[model samples]
Target: MKFEIKRDRLLDGLSDVMKAVSSKTAIPILTGVKMDVSAEGVSLTGSDSDITIQTFIPAEEDGKQILQVSEGGSIVLQARVFSEIIRKLPTNEVEIEINGNFQTHIRSGKSEFHLIGLDPLDYPHLPDVQEDELFTIPADLLKTIIRETVFAVSSSETRPVLTGVHWAVKDGELVCVATDSHRLARRKTKLESVQDEEHNAVVPGRSLNELNKILDDSADPVEVVMTSQQVLFRSKNILFFSRLLEGNYPDTSRLIPSEYKTQVTVNGRALLQAIDRASLLAREERNNVVRFSANGSDEVEVSSNSPEVGKVEEQLLAEAIEGEELKISFSAKFMMDALKAIDGQDVVIQFTGAMRPFILRSALDDSILQLILPVRTY
Candidate 1:
């Protein structure tokens, strides 16, 4: 196989596919990137069994040549070394050629390097997913969904299912929920096209996080194909595949309270700032708990005390306070995360009780909700 390609374009494709490459894989071939040179373009693929990514560089785009293929064949090269060599190449173009013994030759400008290549036939084939069950979503909106919920996924391996974000679609409405038992984040949005079929999948948080980094923040549509075991995300020149978690995701609908006893409205930025200050003292404590109290007054108090450190107290004026007076203590980290995920300036916090999990939502947007369980502080 032989090909001469634009250095920047090759680097772009390598940077994206490298996210799926792992050096500690059982299959040695999986540590390298598979490159296929064809008359149409050049294809680069990387996989670590759980996830696979492929990117293409067209031969000609907009009347400009991006690649020139001398022969059509396939080979695999060490991902890390190849990427580093290409990145440090002194020229804007790179030439690669493979011999009968799988010896790969790379040349650019005044530099040259040789690498032992692996036979592409030995690499595992990508999962064949039927695209019949396909849906489309705006790339920017998908990123928002990931940003809001993926952070809440559990880091513990005790409950493997909680390490992923649950995604369900019904009647063209898509809802994503993530929780680690202590806090939960839920985001909902309407699909561009209405469909009658129902779909549910638990996608690993690690996969979503990596996909978010590759996707551009734009209104361009991203096509998604789902099977029972695998999910595919296709954008302009990229294809991302992730295995769905095997177990059923726990039902999270019942966890959200339908009613509340105490409700307070406050500026989201101000509350975040106050919590930031209070957390400085709370951080010294083991649980990082912060005290919050409201007594149907115009102002609410946020305070934290640490025996070894010091105490912090702040009173912020609330726009409205209704229902019963309440005093609750919660993880400062959890509260800050929920507040930051909310989009609007005005935030409405509803409490079922001092001990029950409280809800936080933007006053203008009902599609997003955040819940945090309060801690016991005598």
Candidate 2:
């Protein structure tokens, strides 16, 4: 196999696919990137068993030549070394050739390197997903949904399903929910192309995070196809595949309260800054808990105390405080995360009780919700 391509173009493909490569992969070949040279373009694939990413560089685009293929064949090269070489190449052009013994040669301006290649035939085949059952979403909106919920997924592997974000689509509306038992985040959006179709899938949060990094913030459509065991995301020149987590995601609907006993509306940025200051002391504690109190006043108190460190207290004016007066304690980290994910200048927080989980939402938008379980502090 032999190919000469624009160095920057090849680096772009490598940067994206490399996100799926893992040195710890159990399969030896999975640690390397599989490259296929075809008459039309070059294809690069990387996978660590759980997630796979493939990107293509066309031979010619917009009447400009991007890649020139001398022979059509396939080979695998060490992802780490190849990517580093491509990034540091002194020239804009690169030439690569493979011999009968799987020996790979890379050449650029005044620099040359040789790498042992693996047979691409030994690489695992990508899962086949039916494209007929797919739906499209705007790339920017999809990134928003991921940002609002993926942070809430559990880091613990005790309940494997909790490590992934639960995605459900019904009646043209898509809802994504993530929780770690202590905090939960939910976001919803309407899908124009999906009507009668329904889907329920648990997408690994790690996969979504990586996909988010690769996607550009634009209005361009991203096609998504979900099977019972695998999910595929296809964009302009990229294909991302993630294995769905096995087991039913716990029902999270019932956890959101239908009514609230105490409600307060406060400026989101102000509250976030107050909590950020209060957390300085709270961080010294094991639970990192911050206390919030609203006593039928225009202002609410945010405070935290650590015997070994010090105490922090601040008061911020609230836009509105309704229902019963409330005092609640929760993880400072959780509150900050919720505040950052929620949009709008003002935030509405509804508390069921001092001990019950409280919900937070943007004052201008109801499509997103954040819930945090109160930390019991005697």
Candidate 3:
């Protein structure tokens, strides 16, 4: 393909799609980026089988000519090399010309490079998911939801279903749930428009993390279209597709306790810092567990003990502490992660018992919840 494009625009497009290209992919050709030029504009695609990202640059946008089509064609160039070369090009405008035999030439300023390109016909076709099942949400809110829960997804692939974030929609509200069995996180939000029927899907956590990186944190809406095997997220200039995991997510409703025996409200930052300090000694013992016990009517003692290392103890005033005397030991890493996801100056921790799972919720926002199972120090 032959086209003279704005370098900044081209770099931005490449930077986003490059996340999908894996250097170690089994299909060698999949390591490259597909560039197609037509009368409309230029399109760049990158994929690693599980996730595919495509970005289009229009000939003109907002009265600025972003691309000039000298000749229309397509070519596949090594993603790493091509991307690096484009970034180093010394001009605002870059010209790309591809010969009939798939030889690609790129030029800018006084520098030129001739690189062998792959056959475009060999590129795998993107998933063909019809746009029947669709929904729209603000990109910023979607990103926020992902950040709040995606971390708890299991990194182990033994239970493939647990490696994805379970997404469900009902009555115009969407809930995202993720867990690694040791801990769980759930985030719920209301959609602006309602759907006729409920929908459920398990989307890979890795894919969602990559998608969040490219997503714009703005008020603009992102359209999501799903099929039996694939889900597509479309924004103004980007098209992202991911293959859904093939198993059903476990029923997690029963995992969250309906009642609590104890509840403690504390400054989120103070609690986080206490855990952070306690983990220093806990890590030395390879346990990374911290204990929280009610000291006074409205105070808590955070402490950790290690055989090889010294112990740490700190007292912090709880905003409100009530119910049965609370004493629970849990992974400081997990608790810290949940604390980071919560949004508020203070958070309430609801405990069923010292052996059962405990929950963390924002004092200001009721839509998000984080649950963690206590460790058996005994």
Please report how far candidate 1 places residue 231 from its true position, in Å.
0.6
* lDDT by residue (tens digit), candidate 2, 267-353: 999999999899989865468899999998799999998888889999999999999989999999999999999854699999999
Q: Lowest summed lDDT over 10 consecutive residues: which window, candidate 1?
A: 279-288
lDDT of 1 by residue, 93-169 (tens): 89999998899999999999999999999989988999788889989999999998999999999999899999898
Cα misplacement distance, residue 222 of candidate 1 (Å): 0.6
For each candidate in the order shown, give its overall lDDT on alpha carbons: 0.93, 0.94, 0.92
Model 1: lDDT equals 0.93
Residue pairs with backbone overlap in model 2: none
Which runs in model 3 stand beyond 4 Å of their true positions? none
Instruction: Return the lDDT, model 3, position 19.
Output: 95
- Residue 163 in candidate 1 has what lDDT? 97
TM-score: model 3 vs. ground truth: 0.98
lDDT of 3 by residue, 1-378 (tens): 688999999999999999999999999999999998998898999999999999999999999999999899989999999999999999988999998799999999999999999999999998998977789999999999999999999999899999999989888888999999999999999988656778889999999999999999998899988777898999999999999988878889899999998889999999999999999999645569999998456789999998788899999999898888978899999999999999546999999999999999999889999999999898
What's every prediction's RMSD, in angstroms? 1.1, 1.0, 1.1
Models 1 onward score TM values of 0.98, 0.98, 0.98
